[model samples]
Target: MSLSKLLTVCVIAISLNSTAAEHSRTIDIDSKVVSNHRATINGERINYSVTSGTQPVWNEEGEPTATLYYNYYKKDKVDDISKRPLLISFNGGPGSASVWMHIAYTGPRILKIDDEGYPMQPYGMKDNPHSVLDVADIVFVNPVKTGYSRILPNKDGKMPSADEQKAQFFGVNADIKYLADWINTFITRNNRSLSPKFLIGESYGTVRVSGLAKELQQAHWWFLNGVVLVSPTDIGIKRDGPVKAANRLPYFAATAWHHKALPTQLQQKDLNEVLAEVEAFTINQYLPALAKGAFISPSEQQEIAQRVAHYSGLSKAFVMRSNLDVSNNAFWKELLRDKGYILGRLDSRYLGIDKKETGDKPDYYPELSAWLHAFTPAINHYLREELNYKTDIQYKMLANVYPWDRSKNNTGEQLREAMAENPYLNVLVQAGYYDGATNYFDAKYTMWQLDPSGKMRDRLSFKGYRSGHMMYLRKEDLKTSNDDLREFIKASLKSQTHSAKY
Candidate 1:
């Protein structure tokens, strides 16, 4: 009856039946004309190639409806089949491809970051000595309509709108089903079913993983060993309801203030202690103050405004004028307006000058966008030349394909239920302290929602980095994150061992 015992039973059941009713098919590659590229990173030579091909998808009637195109990557080792753990990675635009993750974090390739965090010249690829693939097999997947994954024409043969394309192949449930089929087929073809499977998702991909986790379990009957969610966005936080969403603005403010982007006085205190006070104020006092409206009196309002200004590094008058309900967008644009600069919402440390003498929005975060070209080109070349893959498919590095649907389900509750239903499921949620988009505090709040019983709670691990959402971009942060991930994976594998003994 204990949670650990329950989890042990579930793991036993899953391991016993994992391969039941499993089927596989072979995929042949014609490599005669494919171009290959090779790169040396940290003294290790790795190869890859690009292959374009058609993948089959079944229709509603259980018949092959159409063939979808996709680009797949394999490391230097060919047909090694050592029962290595497998990692499947993707970006979150619902329309976005797997470019960032492929090049930056766990892929065999990486984009070079300059001294000031800007992507430098001579944009090229390098062997990622730090890639997690060194421990597991890596496969970056681009969903339909993103990253060369395209569906053949219907009977009428017409191109579909973005919305229509998503409705057909990019919704929550639809994506899970499609990936289940694609991954199952890929694993079957490559003969990796015995390998432990894991998924790594960022931004919107975090949302996708939440739904996919359940679908993969209930619908596909595949129990994942673990999942890593980076910069997660909880639907509950994004929605409007009676549930009081935790205020994340102060944590983001503290990060910006620490980097000297805010003011001098507030920078004097210990960051962790300051952040704790701000968090307490935001949750206990600020929420109620905002809810009371005009009845709270001007003096009380002034006190609240002063606290917001102190924690957020904004002017007291400005906070008071706004009535304390400033949204993320307003905060970004207003925070540094006096200095003729704006900070990136994704990574607050990056600063951008106003393009015109005066403009509402900052010019752009060149530091972040500039890395796309560097990584995309290198990944494409590495996959083709080093991996010995030959294909004509265009790699979709990033796309905004799938948008979050607020109506369909209780996203938070669903994840909690899945964890509760399968107590053995362990999670590693990583957050960048400087990330305003999906604040680290929000991630903590989301994790707190998981069944509070010791079994599920103990399986969960949370880590906060002193960087942005793309924490790996910073060398020091990247090193720390990589080590943390390695430890977490080891812990999960050990958990399986404990289950076996049970």
Candidate 2:
């Protein structure tokens, strides 16, 4: 049935939830509401069932400590269930809800935003024709403290202490452990054990899944077919000091080219051509100069400063003042400082009007604020009204997952290990050229450093988009990215000539 017709048949339920300490309520910890719907995706009709529910995260003693909210979308009319692919997805913030990829990218519903990704009035959702549901089943998972997922209270109505919560669900290792256990349960309950499983994560979610790739294999004995990293983090790859500082040039050039801030010669050329030039200079000249530091001669320093200022759209004086090293923050503020505007941290294409453009960093993230404005309403309405899953609890678009322990993050190496062990496992990375937070260059660097041996290099691939972090927000990328995912899923599921042996 059409979504409108499906919405007419409401199936609301009361579930346990609370946004604050005083507002706690009692309800079923493990609850679900199923709804059937149809939409035209990729020029084909897709009938799918959506299961919106919460699954319990148990402790070692087998006691329920937390419940995770998730939306599982399974396409109907599949002949062989075991051969079908299952795509598990998560968005990053370490604290962010899974709503992003759920509605905006891979799921059947998307926000009612413009082609350029600006929020529109009459906030709602529309059919996502580019969604990958046409090719594979998908589940958007909400980690603890995100979406409606929360730590449960005891039978006596006492919640776990903050320290206890951290120990169980907050840190890097703790998150991977519980979520790996949760995935095992989810797969088993859904009867997808024989299906080809793939994990896709964005931002910090990249770290989560990279670790899970290894943890699931070692801890749960669950092997995956593929992993997708969208706008990935460093994934514990080390690029400190001069290496880190020099990597900023290509991103700087990309952002500058986007705003037409580059010199007429560079601005006139294509973005890729400009980036190629900047990248070569960065490796051959910028990195070496930064390494030499105060030991470098004055002429070389002047030459380096000129090139940095030229590519970064910053003045020579400013580049010299920064000692030939410009932070992303200063670039955001300085690029359009003369124009009296600031660039969005996540997406440089989006313009922000600050009260004063004199600061090193933006007053607020323009891109995030705009996204929250659009996503917050659409997700709530889609869940409660459209999907017919009722709840008094406010669906958090971005939750307070603070004190997020970044102490021990070796997920990059873990991913390498996972790929090395499982010959069936392949990785596909998607990045946006304009994403300043986890820039495309950084994503490429992470991929390059992921498998140092280079034996598994062919199994890894990268795709860059014209937009920023959530590149799918742009209409064009929305289609291309979903296509990339569809191709990757299909390719990974193909029969391999050799077994998984090193």
Candidate 3:
């Protein structure tokens, strides 16, 4: 062969090798940063260690598919590792980060918000004096695309298509499946297999954890001591037509009473007292009236409208025009419309201003904006400055996980099954009366429908707060809710001789 031709072939081989090396370059997915911290919770000093890290999620072929970021807090001095309960916490949104509960509810650090959860200036964090870390070790997890968690490129540096990602991580069932696997891996890695485990989820996290309760037990052979649902979702328990419409009355009454917009009689009564009357009316009169539809006599419909208006702070004429079925957005917009204000969807306690008062809903979520303003800075500062988990990557507080598959959401039944199979598992539901999105009444209704036979009624309990969805954001509720959680955890601890069978 000619010398020039041989040289050309060698150069071509070198170029191909370079291209292959670029494609084969692997990204680091597993890492950790440990730090120690001390905080005074419930008037007692507690020392704890925090492990902030990213754990890899593997595919069926054992290839790393995604990386999940988590912050695990363990009490510094523990006598028995098994005695120390491990609590896995998650927030909702299907795409939302675990930051809400991590910073505001269960974690040792809290955002600097005012008494009623309004954002305070100098956006930062303070020692959460009510955190449950004193009783149980806690781990806050951020699923794919949330927080710093992300899906990685393939070995060939090719990314998974949107469809593939959804099939693996974006749906209700897929979410539970992978999260169950991730949690099992986390437990094994942390050596907490023998410890009594608990799952606490807020908002949509309730759905995630309710499903997790069963998934962990059935698929992973891991049983939990308790499951805490904070501001829970419907959990796949159906509530359509009249049932759904009627359930909104109690929440309306609560929000109206909060805004001082209720009738004089209700305004003068205590919150719980007014709610009792409204709830009774909702179940007895309102639901039947709604179920009757347009077939009912006009006089009877008028009377029902009057009562609904009385409870909802909406005009009788408006309620009548709505055909006695008011939507949440319509109510939020119409409740304070005359006053040139709009009630917040998540927390009606907060007022918002819209471009015009003529819309059916507010232009944006006021409560959410306030939360992001407070939480974004606090989390960014705390995770990097305090916890020392350094990364230039933008911490996604809420990412785009749209095209989210919501089908086959039988999580309520899944939870019921978990309870039936594991007598050790007890469920605690916490909700805020004023949370319009996942109203307290709906949470109660879900609990009632979760077990049709009512066989597990004794194992389920619900707590109502005076605040909004993230009830723990309220100063009073922050302490009270955490106390409630602490009590539930302690009560759920099984005796050494406790049997799995009933």
TM-score of each: 0.81, 0.94, 0.94
Question: Total backbone clashes of model 2?
Answer: 0
lDDT of each: 0.66, 0.91, 0.92
Model 3, residue 131: distance off in Å is 0.6
Candidate number that wins on lDDT, 2 or 3: 3
Writing each residue's lDDT as its tens digit, candidate 1 over 1-502 gives 9999999999988876765523212122222223344655335566754444545665666544434444444455656554456677767766777777767776656777663346766766665666654456667776765655556555565655667656667676666667767666666766777767677788877777777677777776666777788888873444232123236556557665656655566577666666777778877888778778778888888888887777787788877766776666556677777776677777877766766635445567644665664676676776566555445656666555546444564545556656666645678999888887778887777777655565567767889877777878777766677777766666666666555221
Per-residue CA lDDT of model 3 for 1-502, tens digit only, reads 8999999999999999998876653334999999998999878899899999999999989999999999999998798998899999999998999999999998888999999999989889888888998899999999999999999988898999999999999999999999999999999999999999999999999999999999999999999999999999899998999999999999999999999999898899999999999999999999999999879899999999999999988999999999999999999899899998888889989888999989787887789889898999999999999999988678999999989999999999999999999888999999999999999999999988888898788888999999999998899999999999999998888443677776
Q: Candidate 1, which ten residues in sequence have the lowest lDDT sum? A: 23-32
Selected candidate, larger TM-score, 1 vs 3: 3
Q: Whole-model lDDT for model 1 versus the true structure? A: 0.66
Listed per model in order, the count of residue pairs whose N, CA or C atoms clash below 3 Å is: 28, 0, 0
Which stretch of 10 consecutive residues in model 3 shows the poorest summed lDDT? 19-28
How far in Å is the alpha carbon of 238 misplaced in model 3?
A: 0.8
